[model samples]
Target: MHHHAFSRRSAGIHSLPVELLTRIFVLGSQFEYLYEDSPFLLKPVQDYSPAEAPNLQVIVSHVCRHWRQVALRTPSLWTTLHFRKISHIQRATMYLSRCSLSGTSNTYLLDILIDTVAEEDYLPGINLYKNELRTIFQAIVPHVRRWRAFHLKICDDDCKAQARQYLSACGPAPSLETLQLYHFTDYRTAQRLYLATYRPPVIVFSNTLPRLKNVSLIGVNLPWDKSPFLQDLHHLELALHLDNIRTPYAYWDRMLRLSPELRTLCLHYSGPKEATAADPALIWPNLDDKIQLRSLQELSVTDLDPDYLCQVIQRLHIPNVNKLTLDLPDQNFTPFVELLTNSAATGSTDNTGRASNTQASSRFHPMEHSSPSTTPPDSPILSLRNLETLIVRALECSPSSLISLLRATQALRVLQVDFSRVGGGLCQIFNQDPGITPSAASLASTGFVHHPLLPLLKIMKVAGTPGKDILNTLHTRHRLSREPPAVSEKWIIGWDEKRRGTDAELDALVDKGYWSFTGQGRKVRVIIETYDDEEEVEEVPDNDAESGDDDELEDEP
Candidate 1:
């Protein structure tokens, strides 16, 4: 009895006025799909009421009576028919006729999205309306030319081509500003069958999309680069993979040369797939440096190592490319740093004065350490003066190793070193074999002095366990520790400690304000003392109790 009463009360509440209920009910728009209760009862077959069906068109009808009339009045809403609506086309056509009563002068667009495009499912299920859909597209596609945007995305190329058969029924579309084709059929059979007869470039040469601004071709082939005459393209992403075309030097040159107005050019190649495997002599040709790209701004490339890519960048000499994304798999830290040598330091610039327009300001100074180094000879030479942010991911750096790297760069502002050095160190290399530690000795013996880098570098962010001296030397500013007063004791302590320092070298190091440290037991802690203008002094820690005990024992004896 209570459950029945609750149900009755809920039903009465749900019966509230449509104006008050519409807001709460509109939540259904956010949901992507609708599901039926079960297989038990024959699921309620959607009645496909053109007027009552939940759709973008009908949803607008509920906005208000004015919108109801206007929404029902626009043919565009009714023209774009979904494939699922075939179940109620008769009722849909009736609703669409009234919706678009404004006539073909207003024009309209129709779009359909489907789950699968298998020939078996398509031929039998949609064959009944295939002719009708084709007729509608033929009528709409040609007349809707002047519209700002018209798009049709279909998985099955057969359905689209079949729909295009009716194109003869419509006139040329003039006002279309945007047209998008995605997941277009590979049409492999047609590609091979029509390759010999393909004359698409000929047709496209005369047909131009004067206003087309964006083109994205993923895994699509270009019969010829000369066509697809896009005059105002602002962005382009043409994915190339495993292109074994060894002499592609001309391919991109031609493409960029043709697209003079392009602002952003992004190229992604998944492989070094040679276009001509038989031609070993076919070296990757260098780009023409004199080639001028007027409007190009940014360039993004992925899946290539630093050494080869740096060479490519040097050859391209794009003055406009400001931002670069290096997504290559760099196993060794050497290559990435080498490329840092090529960063535009001074005058390197595109014709547009973009970030890539900066030029080199300094010579590449090799470090004097000349130790058995971990870096390679062929690493790219990079300059960091113009570089702002550099993100190095992957585990290939440690504190000591990075100290060697940081000492080589000048313009580095933000540096991040993740924990790649745990349980490893230069000392470990010496422990494995004593021969590795003598590189510093070799340089010292040879009297070779090479200044690594300038102290202008700041803002170093390091992760992982770091050595105390390594961190303190490169990071923190030095500070003096205070001690209790005791003039004679301080002198004696200083005298004892000074005994280890040869007077001459000690004096020189002190004259240069050398910072020194004392080790305790086996630990790496430093013994420090404060300084004042009064006089030179050093004080040891208090051990009075032990001293008193010793004096008492000596007296008893």
Candidate 2:
């Protein structure tokens, strides 16, 4: 009798205001998804199994009658529609209706994400897949005017052709702000399709997207000159083969000129999957005028022809850039390193002023037949005075070049070097030169014989087993922090499991607590008597109390 009375007196959650309940539902819908700010290729339905119900809104609505009413009325909750399967058209249609406030007025802008790949659960036929894509794409066509952010990842030419037709049918996209289109297919398939039909599939959104600020096009052909899509962009990512675009560099320079507000740019070469005899030889673009980026902060160039990359870097003037990342071939590193080394050195701009036109052209020459190491000596010096961070990946950079580069960057604070792609020992190369030894190469050195490098460097993150001097230098830095009262420095190193057997010095450092084990340890089997050893060796803890403690080092005077 007492329990029954208590239940009767308590109020239920449904009695809360609808506005508060709507906010609660929105918060609850914040689930985890992998496709955040990066390109994602949608997998098959079997991969997404233990499948989520057809409609998430319906699932939430069916919880109670009050929830049903509240969810159906919340237009914001239905604005984003992600289609993981081809048969999700029913749920999409339901969402389209609910996203609208009234009978005729579609007040809310939509963000659409579609993955047009057939799954194992669907019937096994190419025609069926094409048909499903057509039906869904047609349904979404009427609402193209309201799209604010549209991302599409499709795999075939038929789908691309169909999408082109739909986009051409739609008029101006005034509300659009971000657009990403990715085509995930091998170059062989694209080549065969191209051979069958002499022309490539192109989508021309002429003067449609005015407010667009961020755009990413991966393997999608577009008529860049004819469209207004390149104007006023702040973030742009392009991954396409040079053969696919006739005048790639002209379009790039024009985009830079039109958008002085551009901040981050990533350019990656997407060559054909397999080489073809008919593929045309690459012709370097003529860059006579220099492009200036006043507001740019970060730039990344990957998998590009070394000569072209050097040409582009030489022709651009970026005074305020803070971070630069490079991932290119090892043979291409010489000219790039030379350029960077000169850029980071003091008084490089003054040198550029005194440089001759012939010298400048020779320095920026497209080294068509010669190697990067054989470039002329009369190159103009550039300056990257504002650069603070540098990241290098998948390139075998020599120790001398790296040391030279570091010496030039007086303002650099963070350095990241990835040696996973190198075929040999990292320590053997860097430690041979005692002149640039880490302990002696202090930025405070100001004499005739010694010169300091990496003056403001505070953080060093290296991947691979380096030599003992590298460890000693880090240790010395840690010891010097006490007298000057410097901020606590951090050094992170990652080495491969295969290196464990051969890198004795690395093991000693790990034992000494100068470095810690962070990566996945290999599985081993151990036995007391007659069996093979396969057990994880116990990791040694950082012993600060026993010896070589931070307090043991003398304070710097």
Candidate 3:
């Protein structure tokens, strides 16, 4: 039966054209590379999971003779070359050989990742793995000119020294576009050793590698003055622990001006000091003061002071920015409010449409549209019309401020209200206080105090546990409103709370019909489901690319 089933499945699958099958195999090979469920790069080949055991090239080849021939001919399926342990050194060479086969183009770009440094801590005598690093470097060094994206992450200083020497010897990488050279040790402790020995050559391409774009540097020192690596970057991340060699704000301004096509900018402990002279674009007294990030769409700043973050935000003119993540020392929503409001008012970007003139229905009362006094005079007073997703981790703002923000962002569709770290202020907004039984009719009578809270809010995902008062408020809001904007019984009430064991209230709502509509002659469907934290993980900042002391603000745009 098993043999017959295999034959039936394989018969139809084999009928697909070789071109389509090759594309499928190419995508399958990159399964480990794209979605990183495991740290396969850090582990040896033998330690790979069963899913990753039979790589794309191997899995397709195992099907049949014709499949094996097609897989062998597909050069793209062999582009990625990963080197880790001593046993894999030969495998790296063989893969590169296949990548450079006669059938493929001579200029087929290669994506190389060399992590041969000792995974464990390096002691005095036990550090005999230098040979492994040298072996891998020698095997992969000759093919540097064809590198499309080169990632060298060495934990040991000696390994980095060898790798740096090899990289310097290669001179100009004409095809190299993305470069990530990281010394995976605490920058503070290893500062002395790095300054003494690891003096890498200034990355001057001399008209080579003009297409270079993304670069991520961590604890790796390079002379920025003469380096072409700093130019034409679309996405750049710099997280060096050296306080003395920190790139000043003026330098950052110059760098930004150089990279006109830059889209994504990430800064972690990489900003200039507050006391330093402000950039030309940020000099407030100047008649024309604006930093036009024409192409910038996404930005991530972590571990910087609130003042610095605000200064940076005020300076940048990201008209197309739709997603923003603020991971500051404190949850100060003032800057966010000012930024979003200004972005909406200006309508500088084509993405943020002008606010609709249609007035709110009888469900809410009209109030004065008051913005923070700190906002610039010329700043627009519109909602964050383009912003659809917002993730707040360190939520420490008042309910009034939170509600004010919600009202301003009429186009917001999804909100992840994280209250895991802070106190229970979020709970107070949703769950009216103990003695205060704020009825739905009373809430409706008053209408909306300010602008209606979350007019377009379709999903509300709370990180921590919500109280009975909060749940009741949502129920009442849905029940009272004649046309409850977007809320429906079938609408989702996603819970991402990390508390152990099932809640009695939740179980009652699920098992029995706890949601009651007494005498109203109405029924609603509130489908409760476990919220996957993976959706929120993108908002967090990359710790490896950012400062070690910085908190995580996982976000994606």
Tens-digit per-residue lDDT, 238-351, candidate 1: 443334322243444444545667766555542222223344332333212323444665555555544444444543434444333343443443433333433333223222
Give each model a TM-score. 0.41, 0.68, 0.71
lDDT on C-alpha atoms for all candidate structures: 0.37, 0.55, 0.53
Cand. 1 TM to true fold: 0.41
Instruction: Give the C-alpha lDDT of model 3.
Output: 0.53
Candidate numbers sorted by TM-score from highest down:
3, 2, 1
> Per-residue lDDT of 248-365 in model 3, one digit per residue for the tens?
4445555666776887776665554233223432222110123556677566565665544544555455655555554444545444444455444542211112222222222212
For model 2 the TM-score comes to 0.68
Task: Name the best candidate (by TM-score).
Answer: 3
Give each prediction's root-mean-square deviation over alpha carbons. Answer: 25.3, 14.2, 11.6
Query: Which segments of candidate 1 are over 4 A away from where they belong?
Result: 1-58, 74-140, 143-206, 225-228, 240-251, 270-285, 288-298, 303-557
Q: After superposition, how far is residue 164 of candidate 1 from its true place, in Å?
A: 9.3
